[model samples]
Target: MNDVFITKAFTYLPNEPVSNDEMETYLGYINGAPSKAKAIILRNNKITTRYYALDKEGNPTHTNAQIAANAVKGLFDDKFRKEDMELLSVGTSSPDQIQPSHASMIHGELDMNKSLAINTASGLCNSGMNALNYGFLSVKAGVHKNAVCVGSERMSAWMTADKFNHEAENLALLEERPIIAFKREFLRWMLSDGAGAFLLEGQPREDEVSLKVEFIDFYSYAHEIEACMYAGTEKQEDGSLKSWADYPSDEWLKQSIFALKQDTKILDKYILVKGAESLRTSFDKHNLDPDTVDHVLAHVSSGYFKEGLKEEFANVGLDFPWEKWFYNLSEVGNIGAGSIFIALEQLMNSGRLKKGEKVLLCVPESGRFSYSCALLTVC
Candidate 1:
């Protein structure tokens, strides 16, 4: 088996950065009334600026595939060519079309010089690590000499006012809460539009340090918990979800089936607690010591979770210094699966890393309650 290394990391945040005050200008107000949830959610998230692939008039300026391809394009140069890549893996919670796979669309958007194995991993946040895991194992198994893994979300389109206007208008017809719950609505304020990609190969970069891939680990508590975040579905009274296909096409619009939803009750109850447990379990599984980590990069939805997660991790004796933590959420907002990759891009270029230092990567997904972790060594 060949060892894998991340030779390059790059990100594409579409358009210019939109400030907190400018968000409603792009996403607009649901039901023509300003969201009561937006200000409160923003206060907790601490996201001052974010990128959207949409214009101020709510028209999308870039497709999900286009942004993904753009991130991939940044990874190529004299050393690596489009025609040389053996695999292209893309992960996202949002895809432009439901018929063709996200990877297939991105492949078409890339318009590479030759055909390659294109894979799409789907989910909310964990999809990024899942995509990375696939490429890591493929290279480790010698199935490919190199692979490009991307995590992207073109979520502005889903957060638009028109998408949720039906639910706001038809609230009286539903068994669920008549008013859109904070859980059902806050994602419009939380998600951003962006794409980030990592280039993996059997050999490390010779000119500068590369991230030696050690391991990628993920855990899901779906059996004990129902979905915490979802789209294209509605939660039932029994905590089960009804698929979008089960409902009539018109009913889809009425219930906002395509709009993203979160069960805040479930999120508050399980996300941090399970994340700490998973982190400890994964650390033990890998036989790693927390003190060895020089930097910690994570996919965080809100600034609120940072201290909460620190407290939970402290409970397990994994309290690394707060200075060891680095997050770009305040600058870029949460890009879902792309969050970690964007964070990695900044860290990789920040000149903070020194040779032989270890970095820890973490991502927690509230959708179905999952956690992913990985270790990389600067070499």
Candidate 2:
């Protein structure tokens, strides 16, 4: 079997600076609340800071394709001609349009070969993992020697002046509004714009060291598919794109547990078996142990969600070496599918992964209720 590896990775944050404090104020008004007190609270609780793709007017600038194009260029400081690339994939929660896919525009903007194969995938926050899976499979299949995977989002345009204003008021006025406040708070965590990209290729020889990274195995489960979703259609006059109901938080958590149950084999022997005999059975299936795994690159889907995983992982006897694995979500906000790649870049940049070290990349997403896990080894 062919082994696919990551050759390069890059992230493009907003060129203009927006402090976490300032962003809290900005988002407070976006939902129409705009009070000094509430804004301060949001800044303190929701996020630290987030980036965006914008123009002079500060409007949501650049289409999803533009973000991907600029990000690819950012990944390669040395001049690389378009003809050098063989395949391209753009994974995003926010697509540039309903059709044609963002890959077409990326290929066009980069002036890449017209013959190059292109595809687009949207699986919410898990899209990055899905993209990595595809890139690895393509190289392993001998279809292409090199592949580019990108994740980008532009949520600034997703909210309009009116919607923004209303969200703010709802945050302040509605006394008994648990659901609305929850939705508004969650949306606030969703940052805007920016893009990240990764270059994948076949296994690199020991001689060329800087970018070589290897893929191990992957597992997924969609047991509770209806827990959360931003689906269905809305009237065009709604200003920003159509919005959907946030899944009940309790249900979402339940689904997450269901997913862990379905895919415990990959994690078996590594961590101490926790809970019922069922969990022990799952552990035995994979022959994994928590202690054997050196680092964990987890899905920081939400601050709350990560906390849940920590408790469960500990309960199951898996000690997550948080220090070894980098987490910057508090600094940059949640970038959806971009989260994992951004985290991966941090791991590589920190020099954390040594030769043969084991790293697990895990993501749990709302809506389509998909949970994905990738076992990777350092080259």
Candidate 3:
């Protein structure tokens, strides 16, 4: 098999940085005071600033396709052209629409002639890694000379002004109690908008520097746990799938929004345990030793998971090098599927990695509890 090398990687974050305090303003007030939801999200998520694709009036500034097209365009140069791309693999949690597919929309936006465009709907956080995995395999197998994998999300569009306004009113009606009802609302503050893309090549030139993909592995523990994160659709009493269009107009309006629903109880229960197990499995299968990995690039949703993840690593008989670990969740919140790539881009530019050094990229997705890890070497 041919080696797959990542020749270029780029990330695009729209608009200005929205601080946690600004997010509190977006949540508005409850009972003439700021909503407690803001406090909960700020305390739990540990995100200081995040970018949202919003205009001055707090309206969506860009579509998902636009965000993706911009990221792909950033990766283009005289050597890599849109027409030279043989495959376009896009992974997205919040697609513009279900039908035309995000990849097709991006192709149209780029005005590319002809290429295999595919959209992988692999939950929220894992979608980017899944898209990269596909592109890596395609290039490795010589199926495509050049492929671009992108993960773009416009989560701000899902939390419309109307939803926040309605949620504030609903919070006012409820009696003082625990804030578990605001899980979905909390996620709105945690998620932001961004796109990341990587250009993969089947063959490498001696004069150029690249990140070589050694191995990529994915593991899932969905069967062992209930749904911890989900968006869109719900099951009916008759064992049939009820889509958004199947519901009443009012019901559809209430449930059809693209916001994600999370059960923190399940997240707390399995995120660390399942994540560590999956990482260990990937390491064992690929023969990746922790002592040899020079740096670790991780896409953890919050800083709160850092110690727990370390403990899990210890449980699996691996010593996690905290000094060599890097993450961007505090600066960018969680961009879902785009998180890992964004983290990778930032780490590569930090001047910490040396040539020929091995780096491990860890991605843990809460949606149905999945994990993907990729081993790469700096060239």
Candidate 4:
């Protein structure tokens, strides 16, 4: 079996615009935190700006999957055809439905024949990495010459900014709905609608830049599953607000970190020193050391997480500057499975990847309470 390598990557950022400063003002009114507040707390304890999808009439527009599919098509040159793609897979958090899957929709849009295999996989933030693993294994097994993997979600479609922003309903159930306040705080940096696609080619030549998937070294602690969970959804009686949770952000953060450390430990045996540098630095109390890594890409939960992530990286001696990487959550917001894909696109566009270079891709999922990391090298 030969190695599988990513040949192309692209992203679809929604058309709507929402600024970080505007979100902070909204949060100030909601939490009464401070009149000057401008940062909305996001997944990784960060602040970010997000773009919303809206119709001409300002109704929430849900079209992230379409945007993602379109982005995938844009990656190819004139030489490739839909017929050339042997498989298509979607890794998304916000699915339009449980059956048929978003991949089927993308396949249809691409006009792929019925002979092509299509499927969907959900692993929260790990969706993209998991899909990559699947594609890597499949190509190595000679199942296909090429595979297309996409990570997309329209998280903004899950809630209406109008209803959630208002405080009238929340005043009545303040104590019982404590999570509502947290949700409102986090909503500002929540994932937005976007799609990220990666093209994986098999049977690569020696001259081509490619890296084989030796195997995924996943380490997970059994007790860490309860750290994060998806808050259930229900219809609002007055349609003023919806979506609530049961816990605070601190609890979620602690559990998430614990799981990440536990699971990442599996790599220690394979690359002892490098694994230590990655694990300790990423989990460091301060920042990641600049010298320990060549480049780093992380799931953008918020500005706070980015800062902490950068700090930890610096602490570990990785030489890259915090600003060298693209953190587009402020621009496109969180794109769930698409976040890493978006970062990869930015990295490629910058021409930063070179042969023999190593990059760290980290992802942490909220709903499934999972953390996954992929160590990729340019061949």
Candidate 5:
């Protein structure tokens, strides 16, 4: 049983930061018109600037693997060599291709000299943590001297107007249903492109403050719950999901079957409730106290949930003052699987952490209602 430590943290956000008004320019207009749901969604999510891997023509400037590979590149310096890495694990909501695994694609982009072990964890936000947890275990078990774990998203490609134009047109002809139309465009305004990577080593860095991996645990309620957020499938009237393969290829365009979606009612209802339960259970199992935490990094899809989440935590005795919280979503948007690591990078760069302090990371996934939390101690 060896101990694991995070020696380095780095992030790569592609291109210039696109402001609220500039999103449509790069993403293009749906149905030859600006998104009517844009302003309202922006107001609720409160994201001011976000990154995209697309050029002005809505063509991809970087693949999902490229961004993750770039983040991995940032982890190396004069003291480190790419070949020294024993493992590479990447997590993402979107992959460059569905055939090859995302990690294999990222590994292909890197300049590593020898064969590298790679793992891909795909899902919603927890995918990154799953990758991290895999890296953590590999390092802890002495199987790997060092591992690079990444969480990234190339959401812009899927969010672009052309992807949903046909469905938007069909809906307009069927009826005057703004709510359903808004649902289709909702994720477009909420997600962006970014990658965050952490270098896990068996020993702590002596020159700089290292984050000691205390524990990484996940709680899932998939058996007791149905999907709240998802893609590649449509929720049937009976609340069952119908896979894309089950539908004809032509029908995929008519309904935009691959669009990222959520049952907002379920998200708003169970996210906090289930998240609190997940936190409380993990805390009790680990014998942790909320008051003992120095900094809390929470990955939430919207800023609208920040305060409400605090209230929920308070109900479960995990209350902490607002000042101890750290998040960077307003400036970066929600980068899905990469969010928690991105927040950690920003918090560490803020120079606020003191040696021996504790940083708790909370990542909740509405895709089937799961939660992941990690405890890190500044060393």
Candidate 6:
């Protein structure tokens, strides 16, 4: 059967790296003295440095569209052109605007005159894989000859001094809700800014090397778990969704600005129990065996989650190859949906993959407890 192949991959990380110490200085005093949340989170996550789309004054330096467009342009060479792409799939947790759509913005930025531009949102960290899945299906069905899939995030823009100050002001309320508070603070420190793009083609030349997409399977356990991480509208007591305009007070408006709410408690449980179960089922459905796996590329946000993931793998009786595992959390933090692709790029650049070798890409998104796993083979 003809398969979709990733012909090219590229990633863009804006600006210089920000160390944990620098983040502390930027965050400054929350209540009194220096804020310890950043320090504690950095220490616990084992993240030393992460790139941000921020200037020296801790302001947004670039928009999400710019970052994603940079990555996509990087994939272009003499053999490829913007018009050659039949589909442009963009995924992001942070979008430039809600109306034009991130994909459309990138399309405009790249000046691509033709292509189906699609934006997959609210998939959180798994959104990138979701975008790739769409491109893969489109190409596999002969609907498109070539496509571009990108995941980008400007998380630094969402995390500002004002947001930290707001959290400080509501410290008491947050303290009363430990789980919510943890999620808020953790995400603030965990998320970083970056973008990754892959050029997918329906066929590859005999001499060209490519990462062939074998199969992709997605499973959602949101029904069994509460909303652990989310943004946008909130449900009202009457079971109707509350519109942004419905908020009549300054306090409500303040809380609604790119609001990201999470229940750390449920997130923890979902990662350990439900997440593992879903992954095992996906593996079974795809006939992915641990022994045949050559590399494992995962998007784990923190050391805490990494430990939980290890436990989950063991629980499912999957022998994880620690030596073959690749991750970039320590250097790049978590770029949400971009993490897995970034790691995959790193693996490809490592020159370890050989023809017929299989690699597994695991992306667990907490937006609504969805997990995406893809099995790819080197060609």
TM-score of 3: 0.90
What would the per-residue lDDT of candidate 5 be over residues 219-258, giving only the tens digit for each residue?
A: 9999988898878899988889999999999889888899
Tens-digit lDDT track for model 4 on 46-81?
A: 434565565534455556567767878876775456
Model 2 lDDT per residue over 1-379, tens place:
6777776678877656556556544343443434334354344435556776654344565777887788787655443345667778778877767677778877777755357788788767767667777877888889888788887776655533333444334435556331233333345444556677888777553533334444433333334222243533221332222332344544332222111111122222222121222232334556767666677777564453455566666665555656645567766667777777777777766765687777766665654345666666677
Please give each candidate's TM-score.
0.97, 0.75, 0.90, 0.70, 0.97, 0.90
lDDT of 1 by residue, 1-379 (tens): 9999999999999999999999989998886887777888999989999999989899989999999999999999999988888999889988898869999998998776788997899898989889999999999999999999999999999889888778877885655544666776878889999999999999999867699999998898998999889888889999999999999998998878888999888888998999999999988898888999999987789998999998898898889899999989999999999999999988998888999999999899999999999999998
Cα lDDT of model 3 overall?
A: 0.78
**Model 2 segments beyond 4 Å from truth?**
24-32, 35-46, 55-57, 75-81, 164-181, 205-225, 232-286
Clashes of each: 0, 22, 0, 28, 0, 0
- At residue 144, candidate 1 shows an lDDT of 93
Candidate number with the higher lDDT (3 or 4): 3
lDDT of 3 by residue, 120-208 (tens): 65568888888999999888988878789998898887765555444445444564332324656667667888999999997654555
- lDDT on C-alpha atoms for all candidate structures: 0.90, 0.58, 0.78, 0.57, 0.90, 0.77
Model 1 off-target regions past 4 Å? 172-179
Flag the better candidate by lDDT, 4 or 6: 6
Identify the runs in model 5 with alpha carbons over 4 angstroms from their true place. 172-180
Candidate 3 Cα deviation (angstroms), residue 26: 5.2
RMSD of 5: 1.4
lDDT of 6 by residue, 1-379 (tens): 3589998889999998988778744443444445446677777888888888887677677899999999999988877877677788878988877777788788878876565646565458877888988888888988878888998888877666566555455645656422224545567778789999999997764665689998888888766655667666554444344556566555553454346656676677676666677778877887767888888887887866776786778788876858877777899888987888888887876778898988888888776688888888999
Better of 2 and 5 by TM-score: 5
- Looking at model 3, residue 354 earns an lDDT score of 72
